[model samples]
Target chain A: MRQETSRAQAPIPAVAGIGLRFPHHRAVREDRPAIGWLEVHPENYLGGGAAIACLEAVRRDYPVSLHGVGLSLGSVDGLDPRHLDRLAALVSRIEPGLVSEHVSFSTAGGTYLADLLPLPMTEEALETVCRNVEVMQTRLRRQVLVENPSSYVRYVASTIPEWEFMAAVATRTGCGILCDVNNICVSAANHGFDAYHYLAALPAAAVGELHVAGHALRELGGGRQIRIDDHGSAVSAEVWALLAAAVARFGRRPTLVEWDNAIPALDVLLAEAAQADTILSRERDHAQAA
Target chain B: MPKLRDLQAGFAEVVLAGRFDALAPYLPADAIPPEDRLAIYRNTARAVMTEALRLTFPAVERLVGRDFFAMAAARFVRQAPPDTADLAEYGVALPDFLAHLPEAAPIPYLADVARFEWALHQAATAEDAPSLDADALGAVAAEDQPMITFIPHPSVRLLELATPADAVADAVLAGDDRAMAAIDLAAGPRRLVLHRGATGVCAEQCDADAFAFARALFAGATLAGLVDAAPAAAGTLLAGHLASGRIAGYALQTQTGEP
Candidate 1:
């Protein structure tokens, strides 16, 4: 459990942020990339060596957000105290502006799948995630934003729509929502739902930060094309449109461009962040005009 | 309909083992079949874990090609699927796993190289702590200094490496896979101290006496006791150590009263 001082400052600025990975750490520090804020997967900085040093240097200039990937917030077996403890230690050390985790689960029976496996949109699943989110918030003493996961499959047991489940998590646990626009686009492509409808259904006030990443379109054997949420390529034109729609709906939150696999040069990530910035600026300008 | 926990349990089983039948009840038979849906998670899991192993044991991957390395990594993942939330901490049992791999039996040196690489990784990722300065060491009395113990840097790791790890690493860094394969691994065991220097984490070969003295000092053996018990040059070895960033900090015990 942590105690938050009322006068605490925001860990991240309300601007375009780039997902800070290891490959571009030196460049980000030396070149001092022009992106407004930086987000890091807290798991990478848990043990704390070079990553921590680079983060410390970067934090001096930019506010950071720890977007965690391995907390398994939806795990039915309960939160791993060890993982939480490591996260708590990292949170205390980094004092990030925003701490976020996925609404999907990753661990079960001591086995970690290492991916944000989707949760069933059932009341039970919602309650489980809400409880875990509460535990995380209480333990970290900071409200953690529960990000919607990209799912390739849906469970038969699920009665709730994904957005409704996301809303329930926030409504129940007082947690914020990290609406990954690309994930919504991917899941919509896979599940035959309109991405706009998904965005429209979200609780606007709970939107903490937004993630815009690229996805690859894969054609299955049956001539079925499904979008894979692989953050390997540049942000697709379609996802950018969805991002514009999301920004229009939720107003401009601190958006991050995530590129994990085969990460490009710092200039490339910075360019993507700049692209996001342009989109945000356009959206903000449009919002003010409206 | 099964409970959420039951669904996750079945889903985890299918993801880990590809046993979709067991998890069929939880999955909806949509346009994309349940098997195909689970395949996405399965592929992601294998790819993520395999990539982690490849990162941790790049030389091993280069030795046996990417295809074979991925296959072996898949097996290792099923055996140990990362207990730690941090991917950096995964592949703990990989060195041992490599030791017993029938495919890797020919290149027994690969396991040692993996161990070396793992140590280097550990040192690089170890907590960053401020190193002790000369002023801090100079503050202690000359007599009490002998009773002092030199603390190794948080990122310092010592290994008795004897394989072609060094040559392979050099070749790997040079982007010459052929040279890495041609490395002669029968080299005699070398005492090395792996530390994150100003440049980065590196493994430097050092004299056995120096390593022994450094190990003793790290183990809380006083300078005078190590001199009496250990072979000569322990003091000289530690002096060289203290002069560099290898000495993280220092502590004075004022003689623990043990001979």
Candidate 2:
């Protein structure tokens, strides 16, 4: 099955990009924005149609990444073969520069919950995630970046810290990291951890791609607000600061601005991408000068 | 300490059933109570499923209004959580679910509209196939042409509904809120051919004979058999479908099982 696809992709350039939602598909295909690359959810394009054609046209101009949201990489039951096969087919079709899935699991007991539910940072969960990551990398025949998930609940069974578990997955399975700064900020705020320390714990070389998105504040009963990573509006000031911290620690990586819900106009995203690009450009220049 | 499986099972229980008490054993007591954290996951699961259902069945959502549709969709998510991780492929039983809803009984055609929407979605996302061109058909000798079994692309779909679901679909597409209320169920039966041409998927109402011809083609009936069965308009049906790319490809069967 690994031999079925031979699409070798270069590491995505350390420039800013957008998540490429449907509203901006035409804008991307026609105008071919100045962003470095575009990322899409592979499940959305698993079946063919105008969506495939539209992406086909856009691909001619930009380096696309198939960031999967539904791989369920930490499921006790393991990954779905059919989903992997379809994803392999899509990877061959698009030849994306990067392929990634979350550290969280969305499916268990043959039922797929639509949300990316968090995993307990325990030895058992780590072993399961490493096993699933190995399966995905071998089946896809490409090193995939496993992202840290934003969480609301802290598991009582969690014996390890979030950063240690993420680093352990990379060390054991040789998988790369899709370090989502917004998610780190969200989880950090929720769990009362410093986001900067979380960024510092990751192996710099393992950080292959970065995700920055907008989140909403969910006010609970006890004057506690959960920073929900909704990706609806503009990138927050706090998340931008965290992204700056990550870039400073890990150097400029291929960053993506993902705005999934209540998507604004294409220019709004471009503006966000521009903000990231400015940060990237400044960091690169600083590294070169130093 | 609970195992990973127990924790996940507990989490799924919290998200799916909102049984926070059962899940509390695995959830840590933090600044916020464990139940509050569980509530976040519960809300997320329902919200994501609701949004997916709304995207797949927008017309039904529009027909029922937001609050009513959200309530119905939430109930549906509990009854039938997605089997596949792909939300695009989820909601396979929505039409059937709507069919049995007591609240939906007042507008019996809502289920029909959902079915129509799902059909369109299937057509839109179905695989693109290579259509057999005129050159290939021309090369096949005229005598052997009738024996050819033309294949429709996987993108082809048909909707036969009693209600004027097509008109309601049109109103939804046009974003005409007023037109929905004035919908006429008296417009007669709809037998629509939803096919993906070179441009995109389009829906056109077909008469009985044309629909029968489409159904047969979809079922892999050979041209000569179809022509012989309905010889009166064989020429028109064949010509129309062949040009439309609905006749995607063809195969001539061997009489002796040796091609």
Candidate 3:
């Protein structure tokens, strides 16, 4: 499936993009801002109505991508064909530039917890994720990028680091990576790993897109800070610094400003996208000068 | 250390079953309390499922207060988790769930109201099918009527309720109701066939013959068998339905024996 889809076409030229939310759909249709591209959660548009119509309108203008939040690719169970079919239908309808799912499972045994739960970095889980990605790509007749998930807990049984698990999935399935910098930072800080090491270890060629989002840190009774990847606030200064590092290393890729909770106004999200654009442009200049 | 499957399975238990005590020992010390971490999953599940329910029963939610709807929805979630990830297709059993609720028993018609809402929800998202043209129906011969079968609209759903619960849907849409108290159970024993009309979904009382025909169609019974079962009113029902565009296609229903 990956081999067949990869031959169809490469995505829109790697540059900064935005995750198009409903609040901003009208603005997107009216203003047509100069961003590299836009991405949306496929589940949100599964029903054909005002939302789907809005997406259709937006897709006509922007290079849209379908980023799935509920695929449960790493489930121990077999892939849900009905879910896959809905996604396929959406893909056919939107003709998105790229379609992606996280390397995490949100459901098991038919009940969906509906959060991107962590997958233990082991050979078995890697195989499960690869097979699922391959199945998804084959059914959709398209290649899909696998995004790294934010982890609140690390499994003691993990045999490899998150980067190695990610690279192995990309290598095995011939899929691309959606490097989510905020997730990397959140996981690293929570688990006591070096975020820079994670960035350095990623398979750069597999990185097809990037996700930058805001997060909040909550201090527990024991004084331990849990960095929640909430996507509720503005992109923090720390996350911006990390984005600079990632952009410097990987060059300008298709970056999306992901604010899922308590979404702000359109201009605010676009401004966040503009900030990412600044970093990507700066990186481009450095590359050119060098 | 537990294997990867063991860990994920344990985490699933924590999130879906609200069992965090067992998960505590497995959690890393540097991380937040496993229960709090688990609460994130709980909140997430609620948010995603609640959002799906909102889309499925917007009118119902508006009819009942959002807070009441959420409470009922939370109970429904615990009782019947989705069978698949296609969230649009997930909540089909919600009406049944509502029917058996002890607290909901007083609001006897609420279950049927939810049933109507579910039917509408299903109709809204079902695949689009082209309406059969008049020329196609005209092509059928009178001699071939014995073998005729009918296709109901892809979005057509028949629901029998104890009250005009559909009016609650209309009331909610009109924003006339501020609370669940506005629901009037005395208004019914209504037998409505909620279906997608040319413009959108509409509900109305299904006269006996039309109701029987719809039931037979949904059961995959042939038109001849449907007519034989309800011989007196079948012809009128058939004509009414055909003209209404409710019957979208027809095929021959072959009988096995002389009857």
Candidate 4:
């Protein structure tokens, strides 16, 4: 039964949302947090059973967004329709505020790497991504958001810049951009590019959501730090500062506090989300004061 | 002149086949040393995928120890990278891979044990649907029984094994290593009916009649047809299936395509 009111709520209103992981399911169900929204990995609920049942309960109170890490959107072998179909089914089930996938490819030929593998920022890659996004949107019957991936390696054949590639995908496919501040920080440090330049190059209006996460910095051989976006710890001060800047510029977007590995207690995750909500509030105040 | 496909292929090779020497030249120097960066991916791919195998094949891991299991898991991941993103489905091929592995030849039963565990993992995630009522079968007349296909509950799985796979899994789950060690060839060829009840996935030794009824239902055999084609112990089979939730709901095959 459709709600008689045709006026539906907007995609999480530029506030701090937390990533709803498996461990936190019970807690989230018991105590509904006063957070902006929630994000979940679509692949986790592919077949549907208890986990899907849990998520169905969570969806009633919160605006849910689907973030896909395993779609392998940039794979050269073309998009996997089976995965797309499952994703479409999930989207239909939850009616998530937004659906997003990484710009990285996780598989090649027929095998899945299961990691967020980087893609060369070439014209061919861009065309493949755009076409895939178009197909995905058509199948889902909704606009999708494309996120930039953190990388430890870059391709020599890549002529286009990461920001340019992201902007082009959004522009060509009519998709939205899910700008991840941690990815920008990691990619910038890895590739020796300016993070701000990458952010500035983005088509601002196309960005529908933002992602903020923690990273692990490993000391390399020559005093260089290899920062991996592990998302295991609390949001670092540096990433938080960058997010503040983003909110100031983009006027606040639905942001996610993603901690996949070494997930902390539900209270800890909620605290982190509260901190992000504070930043969003500060930005809103600044806009109002202006 | 590398196309998108060429780059993707090379990237996969570097990660899966350890062909990093070819991809090293293509990586930028500002990042970590190409090989070290590649090692991050390799270690990650190994760890994430190995964890799935460990979950499905805990008995195998217990038999070989953690260190050996990790090494075997890395090898399995390299051979059979997951076809889907669902991590639960990633380790389905580990048993097959173990069966053919030169190192695993000595422990021939290891593969079958892993297969049994994987089936349990699959059953845990299978979709749940209401089972057909046995009383509903009485309504169907004898003439129309041929078209009657009894749909088994989604939770029920028919596993026929020549080895004591069920006993091994039961012992492992019960934390009885001695029971696993005491298994002898004399105790061979057992069948198990695995189903998800109100509590969780319950595994039990199904009698011949019960097994036949479940299989017949899975094959879309109706009650009337099942009675004619079933073994002489058909009554006992229906009783056992009904006692458990294995026959949750059933429908006419002509009415519904599959259970």
User: Residue A42 error for model 4, in Å?
Assistant: 1.0
For each of the candidates, what fraction of the native contacts does it recover?
0.84, 0.81, 0.49, 0.74
Task: Name the 10 consecutive residues with the lowest summed lDDT in model 4 chain A.
Answer: A3-12
**Candidate 1 docking classification:** medium
Interface RMSD score of each model: 1.4, 1.3, 2.3, 1.7
Deviation (Å) of B31 in candidate 2: 3.1
Worst 10 residues of 2 chain B by lDDT: B3-12
| Residue B57 displacement in candidate 4 (angstroms) | 2.8
Evaluated on the second chain alone, the candidates' TM-scores are 0.89, 0.90, 0.83, 0.85
List model 4 lDDT by residue over A140-212, tens digit each.
Answer: 9888999988988888788998999999999899999999998998878877898887887898899899999
Please report how far candidate 4 places residue B158 from its true position, in Å: 1.2
Question: Which segments of candidate 1 are over 4 A away from where they belong?
Answer: A1-11, A265-268, B141-147, B162-164, B175-184, B252-259
Q: Evaluate residue B58 in candidate 2 and report its C-alpha lDDT on the 0 to 100 scale.
A: 86
Tens-place lDDT per residue, model 3, A1-290, is 54443221326657777888878888888898887788889987887545677788777767888999888999888578878888888888778888889989977776777678888788888888988889988898777899988987776567888999999998988899999999999988888898888889888888888889999998876776788899999999888998899888787888988998899988888899889989988998898999
Residue by residue across B156-227, what tens digits does model 3's lDDT show? 778877787887777767777553457656865677776565677767687666776778866678667877
Clashing pairs in 4: A14-A253, B131-B248, B131-B249, B132-B248, B132-B249, B132-B250, B149-B220
Largest TM-score belongs to which candidate?
2
Cα-lDDT of candidate 1: 0.83
lDDT of 4 at A50: 75
